[model samples]
Target: MADFVDREAIRHCLARLARGEDRRDAGLIRAAWWPDATFDYGVYSGDFAAYLDWVVPGAEAISNTQHVLGQSYIELAGDSAKAETHVISYHRVDMGAGDRDTCIGGRYLDTMARRDGEWRIADRVMLYDWYQDWGAAIDWAEGVMGYPFTAGHFPGRARGDFSATFFAAGQ
Candidate 1:
């Protein structure tokens, strides 16, 4: 029972982290890490706060982003845990002529600890499995109905988007 609960808590933490990145919510992203946590992502390796500062703006620059989570394997020992989670992320970049889509397959190996009864990541290393990029064939914004799918109608991940309003309203 304890293992199950720990697994769930750790999974929730990971989910929150992913949602933060997808939604561009800095606070939510910050919540996933301890104050002195560390991170390594091949391209960058430093404190968690620095990682957040570096990643958030870059993510915001993209037109849209989505992170698809797969499986997580966790090992728990009392108030500490280690996990490896699989992920596939998609980013759309507008380049005037057309949009470029990048797909990345990776895994996050994390060391987590429970502090004050809350689980947060203490250290994380992101391993890249594969990556690919190509021009998008069809633009969703220019669908057959001629309506821009991302234009305010649907809630977005970024600040001031509908999701922020919806979440703020508590519905």
Candidate 2:
């Protein structure tokens, strides 16, 4: 039972981190890490606060992002745990030329610890598996296959998005 609880908490933390990135919510991202946690993703390496500062703005610059998390392999030892989580991240950005869609497959190697009855990541190293640029983004205003999707049917923004409002009300 204790193992199950630990695993559940760790997985929730991972998901929360992903959602925070997609939403560009600093508070949500901060919740997933310990006060002194560290992070390294090749481009940046530093304490968690520094990482948060760098990541949130970077996310905001992008038009949109979606992180799809796959299977996670976790090894538990007392209050410390190690987890490798597979992820496929999709991003829509204007890379100098124009807006484009890109996908990156990677894994997050996380060192997690339970402190004060809360599970959070103590350190993380991101490993890249592959990357692909799918060229320019399509015109969503044209609608898909003659089916129009306007109004509330749109991608979530970094802030003031439908999902953010929905989740906020629930809390």
Candidate 1 segments exceeding 4 Å error: 59-61, 94-98, 137-140, 144-151, 155-161, 169-171
Q: Model 2, stretches more than 4 Å misplaced?
A: 59-61, 158-160, 169-171
Tens-digit per-residue lDDT, 48-85, candidate 2: 88988877877533788899999999999999999999
Question: What would the TM-score be for candidate 2 when compared with the true structure?
Answer: 0.91
Error of 2 at 162 (Å): 1.3
Error of 2 at 73 (Å): 0.5
